[model samples]
Target: MSLSLEGKHALIAGGSGEMGYHAARALAAAGCNITLMARGSEGLTTAATRLINEVDGDVLTVTADLNNRLSIERAVDHAEESLGPIDILVHAVREDVNGYYDQLDVARLQMAAQTLLIGAANLVAAVVPPMQEAGDGRVMFVIGQDAIRGRPLGLGTCALQHGLLGLMRGLAREVAESGVAVNAVVAGLVDTDRLSVEIDQIVAHTRRDRSAVKSDLANGNAQRRLIQPSEIGATLVWLAQDEAKGLCGQAMVIDGGELG
Candidate 1:
């Protein structure tokens, strides 16, 4: 499959974070014009600049709070205006409230649902019109391992994650005739700068050795190591390619082999 994405325009929500940042770099390197959207301008600017320095693309930033519908609407409009119609859309946003299911509050649950599920639906709605008209579009969602198998880690996130599968499937069916594809990339133990800090916190809180913490993080995966953000980024790039037309409504697991 030809992976060349030359001239494609990509709108990435939560593009300033680890997953989004590398996806932007991968897409840009693959020849897609890039736009990064995040809640903060500082990270957006830094991410855009880094992408520009690393790859050739017209990189831009859009600041919007994902939980706010109006803010999202404006950001989508601005992103489309900045880079033209979005040929590729990557929703890499994540909202996690960790705790036992019973310990979570109703309001926090709602917020997580809005950010991961409703927010994604709204973004896709905004970008799909142009795609449907153009008869071509690729949408990829960055999801967590929690979406794949049930674990105690993110009891609060199961609803959002599972709902995402349903949302993507429905959207995929809706846009199939229009030559658009929607899918999720389920990632596990992604090794990022954020993960490094997280490892530190785990060791301090649990009074476990660094090695043990790292081991537990990779325990469910066969590879027993963290996945790189770029690996997921590259996977997103591949999913957006013309060769991936048949992949709609699918969840591409990038975890290093989940344990049975």
Candidate 2:
């Protein structure tokens, strides 16, 4: 079945990054009017320009800090004013401050919580009311595989994903009767520029061969290959379409069998 989102308005948070940028492109290809929100105007403008060049659709870029509630409200409002009412919301925001439990600092932990959990919750709260009134909308969060299987050194990240899942479940139930679906896409180790940088750091810290470390990371998955950001973006586009109406409150894991 074709999942066409023609005429749909989509608002994507963190849309300047790899995953979010790909997601925006996919949605635009599926015929949705797209608005991407990020912290700075420069990255957002660049991403928006790329999408506009790639797809025959309207694309808007907004600068707003996800960590700030007021900023999020203004961003959403601005998007609505520019692109009509939002029919889809995709949150691909991530704050990856890697540290072990003993080494984790309070300020960093608080920032993590604010960005991942609180920011997502605020965005949901801002959009859900109008969506429910209209009796149609799709809200999706981008989670990680480490969320399914708990991580020792990645405790902060896992906590954030878990909290987001809980929030999604509650919102899904609350809006079920109104026909608004809320869900999450659980991602695996993706081969993005950011991940490449992270792998470099890991190799330096562990004093292991880059190839060996990459092999070890892939060994966690049956595919033995890192996922591409566009693959996740395709899945998000599918989930946001009208045909995915039955998929509410589900944390759909796309981990390439890594967690298993």
Candidate 3:
């Protein structure tokens, strides 16, 4: 089936990052009005301009830190003010994670909870109510292996992913009658510039060579290669389209069948 998403408006959080940027580009090509939100204005401007040149849609940029709920709410309002009510909301934002679970402490947990898990809730709250009035909406969170299975050395992250999954599941039920669908896209070992950090964590945990760790992850998938960011973007695009209205409250895994 073809995805023709014209006349929709989308707000992509963390729109300057690889996953978010690619998703924005895909959404723009699908003919939706695009609002790219990120903490820094530099990359957002670059991404918005590049996307504008590539697709026949409006690309707007908003700069705000996700850790700030007020700022997140303000950005949501700004996007709606400029682009109209957001019919699609994709959250591709994440915080930098390093070190092992044993090293975690109260301060770190609180920060992660506030910046990531709680921040996501704030954004969703700000974006969804208006959707109920409009009678159609799609909300998607881009998560990783940490959410589904426990990360060996990244337990703290695993916890947050679990929290996000819980939030999505709960929201999915609450908004079902409102004609809104809430779901997640679970990706694993995707080929992004940030993969180096994941490799580092694996190496530090397994005491293995960087090359060995990288190859192991790449070959872990049935496809024998790292999943591309564009693949994730494509999945997000599909889920937001009208044809996918029946798929609600689900985690569509895009990990090349890594977990059977």
Candidate 4:
């Protein structure tokens, strides 16, 4: 029941996005210092400013490219220097490249993989080792449902998610005894700004009403509504707790029973 992360420092990669922002808010509210990292300086600044007002802990923003290992390293170094060692790492970076498996653009898929999978590897290489050395830490990957079930339009994302799931499992086993837990949150149809944009795109292409398109997405889940961002945020907070060590390498599905 004690989920107080009072002295913990968490680095949320891709922290500018809706999902990441809410996760940072939750972690900060639980008394953890937060470092928001993303490629866009503007979004980082805006997110940090808002978080500073809403949360009790300190918020730092680092503008870095996920695809670049050096950039990730620099960001991590700066965050550790400013807020101490990162006791929790939340990987929520999303690449918007999608195509059918049969007609996939190899180049685009490769690029997406570089950012989502390789970038995650780079982050883990930099962050997890330290946690293992210290013998305490948590890593959570916020990914999509395509990882568990193939989506025809999300070939690239599906590939990346599967790869990330593998990475999480392998790393969890490698570091389990060291007191570091690695897991993933498989999200589905979450109510986010990105989802809204996606819905708009579908409406424009299919000539459907905006409400109809949104309703279709929401209806994909049994709850008949989009998953709230706060729900995902709360789940991340729980997984970050010391007591959740038993959840090693598991993919916690938070899709309102959509997968069912």
The prediction achieving the highest lDDT against the true structure is: 4
Model 2 earns a TM-score of 0.95
Model 2 spans with C-alpha error above 4 angstroms: none
Candidate 2: tens digits of C-alpha lDDT, residues 180-235: 99988998988888777767877777799998888777777898888888788889
Q: TM-scores for all candidates?
A: 0.92, 0.95, 0.93, 0.94
1-260: candidate 1 lDDT, tens digit per residue: 57899999998888988889988899998899998999899989888888888999799899887667788889888888888888998988877666666777779888889788878877877778889999999988888777867766457777677778788889998898999999989988798776777677567656999988887887867887789888998999999988888998999999888774
For each candidate, what is the lDDT? 0.84, 0.84, 0.85, 0.88
lDDT of 1: 0.84
Give candidates' CA RMSD values in order: 1.9, 1.5, 1.8, 1.6
Which ten contiguous residues of candidate 3 have the minimum total lDDT? 94-103
- Tens-digit lDDT track for model 3 on 1-260? 77878978999988998889888888888788999998889999888888888889888899877767788788888888898889999988776455676677657767878878878888888889999988999999988777898756666778888888888899999998989988899988888888888888778777899998899888887888889888888888899977888988999988887843
Q: CA shift at 44, candidate 3, in angstroms? A: 1.6
Q: How many steric clashes between backbone atoms does each model show?
A: 0, 0, 0, 0
